[model samples]
Target: MSNLVLFTELRQRLDDHLDLVSRVAAEGDAESALSMIRREVPGLVAAVHALVDEHLPDDNGSCRKCRSGPFWRRIPAPCRMLIQVHLAVGAAKATTRDRTRWSPSRHRLQESSVD
Candidate 1:
């Protein structure tokens, strides 16, 4: 599928998943909500990969050795911008998990300081 069409579909899917996640969270089902969000990640990654492959410059094929280096610069500006936005969204999603993992360490530090 074309990038525009794929992007639109992905956006809709993401919205729907977000709504479901919110509902599940409200219902006190954190595991289900997290599962729903995680399930959508692979599809998003695949769509982005397809977009990159479709937009890569012709010279990209010859640079197989340094596969990751130059290919991103070849993607069109709009697609690159979309990718950046997606990455930011992913990082935002990960923040909750990061915070959860850090909470124990933070509590331990607080306890040690109190003594």
Candidate 2:
């Protein structure tokens, strides 16, 4: 299947899951809905990351968003390209790590650190 088809399928599945969770929440099972979301969120993120990486080309060496500086009056193409590349790589690595770490059983070991 094409990447667009795969991405659409994943997006539909996530939307369906969220709809179910919303229904559950409306029935006064908010915590259970939250748990379901927490379980699926990693997969959703991975799907999004995959879609973006598939559609976008890597390092065309041109900053499409390159802007001129007010003080310097110059568009820093090199710096912008470097920053974009760094962010892209970092995002890919983080998404991969998150996908690897996600599991249904992993949720049981989570603690409420904020409280």
Candidate 3:
């Protein structure tokens, strides 16, 4: 298979795994939820750390990973990737705290079919 296909499949699998984890978090028994969390949370944290580590600034405070290919240039530390991770993690934390909290028109979200 092509690299793009492989990458897409990998993305789908990760999404499915996360979805399963979400379901377990919301609907599983206490014992099952605890067991799943114990088994999964560390691995997920490690993976996130690995991604962050790749984007960390080098000695000159430049993002080495992001500077490559046609646009070969050393972007500054706390590059777009790091910024995105920060915003996404923050939003995710807020989402977890209140899953039902959603503003449609104000947030510019389309009305959900369920709503």
TM-score of each: 0.35, 0.32, 0.73
**Model 2 accuracy (lDDT, Cα):** 0.53
Please identify model 1 stretches exceeding 4 Å from their true place: 1-28, 60-79, 82-115
lDDT per model, in order?
A: 0.53, 0.53, 0.74
Q: What does each candidate score in C-alpha RMSD?
A: 11.0, 13.3, 4.6
Residue 11's lDDT in candidate 2: 95
User: For every model in order, what is the number of clashing pairs?
Assistant: 0, 0, 0
- Runs in model 2 lying further than 4 Å from the true structure: 1-15, 22-28, 58-115
Query: Candidate 3's residue-wise lDDT over 1-115, tens digit each?
Result: 9999999999999999998996897689999999999999999899989999899787877787886644446688889878777766654455333443334234422333442
lDDT at residue 84 of model 2 (Cα atoms): 48
Which scores greater on TM-score, model 1 or model 3?
3
| Worst lDDT 10-window in candidate 2 | 101-110
For candidate 3, report its TM-score.
0.73
